[model samples]
Target: MTNELIQAQFGPRAMDYVRSSVYARGESLGALLARLQRDPIRLALDIATGGGHTALVLSPLAKRVVASDITGPMLRVARDWLAENGAENGLFCQHDAGLMPFPEGTFDVVTCRLAPHHFADVGAFLHSCVRVVRRGGCVAVIDNVTPPEPLAVRFINAFERLRDRSHNFEHSLPDWEAFFSTAGLRIEHRQQFRTPIDFGAYCDRMSVPERTRTRLRVMLLQAPAAARAALNPREVDGRMTFDLGELLIVGRRAAR
Candidate 1:
C-alpha cells in the first residue's frame, strides 16, 4: 500500500485533522477493548495511529506498543496525544504500513484502523501485517467498506475519492475476509461502525475546492433513488445532512 498521497495530504494538516475529524468521534475505547477476548500483551503495534486514539486505547492492555505512520508530522501528533493520555509505553515511529521496517513474528497484536483506504495496495498491506504478527497472534483492521453491490460500491468509492484525494478503495466484507485469508490471517471477529458525518463539516475538513464540493453535494443529492433509500441518507430540515460508514474487523494470523 503506497502512502505517498496520505503523507502529502495529511502531513501538513495533521493537527487539524486530529482535533476535529470524523474518525475521532463514535466507537468508544471501551467498545474496542471489550471485543478483545484476552488482554493484548507481549508485543503490539498500531499502524497509522492517527490522533493516537488506538494506541491510547490499547496501550495499557499491551506490554509494549509501536505506533507508526507514514508522515512524521502525523506521528508527532500521535506521540503528543499518547503522552497526554499517559500512555508512555507507546512509541511513535514513521513507517509505511505497506513496507514496514519491523521484523517478522515481532508482534502479538497488530491493528490498523480507518487508514487502509489510503493504501494503494491493500493486498500488500495485509501481507505486511501478516509478516510482522506472530502465528496465532491477532491482526485487527478497521476500515470503511463499500456495499457488496457493484453499483453501490462504485458510487461510494467515487464519492469518497472526490471528497478526499488520498482515498483509494473500500473493499467489501467478503473481499476483506479473502484478503486476510490469502495473507494467512483468519477472521475471528467483525463489526460495522456507521458514523454519520455532518455534510458541511465533512466537506470543510478536506478543504475541498468550492467547485468540487458543489459537485460532491450534487452527486450525493442526485444518487439513484434505490441507493438513497438503502443509505437512508440523513437529512436535516429538508437538507442533506451526513454520510459515512466503517467496519471494525479482526483477524488472527493462523499458524501455517
Candidate 2:
C-alpha cells in the first residue's frame, strides 16, 4: 500500500521533478560536485532517482551510474530525461530503497537526494547503502529535515502528509547522525541549507485536492506560535512561501 501510494503520487509528476528548479539547482548539488571533484568516483548508485536529476549531475564524474527507483513509471521518465540530455553513463533500475538488489560492494559512491522522506524505513535504507558501497566508499544524502521540537515535528509532518500522502516523515539532524553511526558509516561532511518552497507549486506538484490544500493553508495560518516560528510561513506577491530545512550529509563506509 505504501509503495502504491508513492508510485501513484510520483508517476505522473515525474516531469515536474525533472524540471523543478529547486531540485535541479541548489547549493547542495554544488557542494556534492565539489566533493566529487576532490575524490575520484568510479561507479555510483543513485537511490530513488526521481527524474534522474542527481544521476545526470553524476554521469560525467563517475564511470557509470545506476539510477534506481521503485516506481516503474518514474524510472521510465527518468531514463527518457537522461537520454534526452545525452547522458550515456546512466542506467535506470526499478528497486526499492530499503532492499536493493545489487551485490555487496557494488558501488564506489551511493547518493539519495531529496527523496528520503518518502522512505518507510530510513534505517534499512542506510543499511542497504552501507552494504552496497565498498569499504571507505562515500554515501551522500540530502533531504528535508524537521526541527527537534515535538510540536514542530508533528505539525510539519502532518501538513506534509496533507499535501502528499506519500510523505513518511522528515528526520532531524540528530536522527541522521544516529542512523549513520548505527550503520557503521563515519560522517565526513554535513551542512544545512534553507530551501524556499512556493506553497502553490508545492501543492500542485502533488496534485493535492482542493479541500486538502485549503486545509493546509488554514493549518499554516492557525498553527501555534512555535510551529509558525519554526516554519516561518508568509505571503509573497499573493502567493504563500515558506522555507524548508534541508540537510546534506556525506558519510563513508568503514574500512575494517
Candidate 3:
C-alpha cells in the first residue's frame, strides 16, 4: 500500500482510534507493561502509534518515549493526547515504519502495537525496528495474525480488505518468526490472545459503506469451515462477534 493511501485512510479517522477500546485498553498492552517492568528502558520508540496509547504507557517506564506515525494528523492527535496525559517525556515524529530516520542503536526499546498489519513491507519495518534498537534491546510487536491454512489466510485478508482499503496482509506466526530472525532479532517472548471483535463496531470503525457492511456480515456468517475455525465467528445478544488471533511477540537484538 502507498504511504499516501495510508495517511488518507487513517488521518481523518485518527480520533476514532483514541476512542477505540481495543486500542486504548487491550490485554496486549497490559502484557507489554508486565514484560518490560523489570527491564531498563532509557529511550523507547513506539512506531505507528495511532492514538499514542502505547507511547503514553511507556512514558513512565522509559526516560523518554517517541511516538512516531506516518500520518501527520495521527501524530498531531497522539501528541495532544500524550500531552493531556502529562507525559512530560513524550515526543512525536512523523515517519514511515519501513524507513525510520533514526540512527542505529538509537533506542533502548522499540514497540509497534496493532499496526504492523498495515505495513507494505513488514520485513522492512521489522528490520528498521531491529536497526534502531541498541544491542540487547528488544523490539516488540502486537498485531493480528492469520491462521496457518492458506485458504483461511486468503479469506481473512479479504474480509479485512473489504472493510478498509488500506488493509494489508496479516501474516501467520511462522511468517513473523522468520521475519524477526531475518531481521537479526532473536525471539525472547511470545504470547497470543483471542481478541474479540464486534462485527458492527469493527465495520463502523472504518466507516464501511452500508452495502459493504452487508457483504461483511454475509462473509462472516457464511465463512468456510477453516475461516470460521480461525475466527470463531458467532452471534452474541443479537450482535455478531468473532475472535481475531492477535500475537504479541518480543524479539531482542543479539548482545554480541
Candidate 4:
C-alpha cells in the first residue's frame, strides 16, 4: 500500500495499538528489551514506533530516544504515552521507515518492531536502519513471519492483508536473514515466539466488516492442512484464536 493509504488505515486506530496488550506487553517486546539491555545505548531510534512502546522501553536505557512513524496520529499518541511515563528524553518524528532523514551513523542503535510487514520495501528499510546506526551499533527487529511452505506463505499473507490493508508481505526467517546480510548487518541474536491472537479483537482493531470477517473465518476453518498446521487456529473459550509466528533478531554492524 502507498504511504498515504497506510496512514489512513492506521490513523484512526492509533489509540487501539497503544492500549493493546499484545503491543504494549507482549513477549516479543520483552525479548527485544532484554537483548537491548545487554548493550550500552546513548542515542537510539525506534522506527515505525506505532504506539511508541519500543521507544518507551528504550528511554530509561538511552540518554535520548527518537520515536518515528509514517502516521502522524500514532506519533502524537506515542508522544503522550512517553510524556505520561516521564520519558523526558523522548522525541517524535513523522517519516517513512524506508526513507529515514537522519544522517549516517547518528544513532547507537535502531529498532523496529511489528511494523515491517507493512513496509513496501523491507530491503530499503533495512538499508536505512544500517545507514543511520554507527558501525558496531545494532539494528533490532521483531515482526510476524510466515512459514516457508508456499501454500502456507500465501495463506498467511492473504489472511493478514484481509485483516489490515496496510499489510504488504511477511517475510520468512530465511528472507529476513538474507535481507540483513545484504544490508551489511551481521546477525547476532535470533529467537522465535508464538503469539496468540484473539480473532474477534484482531478483526475489530482494523474495523474489518462483518462480511469480510466471515470470509476470514472460513479461510481459517477451511485452510489447507499445511496452513492450518502453521497457524494453529483453535477455539478459546468459544472465541476463535490463532498463533502468530514472531521473529526477533538483532543484527550488529561490523566495527570499523
The CA lDDT of each predicted structure is 0.79, 0.89, 0.91, 0.94
**TM-score, one value per model:** 0.92, 0.96, 0.98, 0.98
Model 1 ranges with Cα > 4 A deviation = 28-30, 237-239
> Could you give candidate 2's per-residue lDDT for residues 18-107 as a string of tens digits?
888888788888888777676789999999998888898899999999999988877988899889989999888898899899999999
Better of 1 and 2 by TM-score: 2
For candidate 1, lDDT tens digit of each residue in 1-256?
2467787888888887678656565673345677654854777899888877787778888878899988999889988888877888987788877888989999988888888988888899899998999988888888887667888788888888998888888888888888888887778887876666677777777788889989988877787654464355668877667556677778888776
- Higher lDDT: candidate 2 or 4? 4
Off by over 4 Å in 2: none
Q: How close is candidate 2 to the true structure, as a TM-score?
A: 0.96
> Quick one: ranking by lDDT, best first?
4, 3, 2, 1
Q: Show the colliding residue pairs in model 4.
A: none
Pairwise lDDT winner, candidates 1 and 2: 2
Q: Cα miss at 178, model 3 (Å)?
A: 0.5
Better of 2 and 3 by lDDT: 3
Error of 4 at 47 (Å): 0.2
What's the lDDT for residue 28 in model 3?
88
Sorted by TM-score (best first), the order is: 4, 3, 2, 1
Which candidate's lDDT is highest? 4
Q: How far is candidate 2 from the true structure (C-alpha RMSD, Å)?
A: 1.3
Q: Which pairs clash in the backbone of model 2? A: none
| Cα-based RMSD of candidate 4 | 0.8
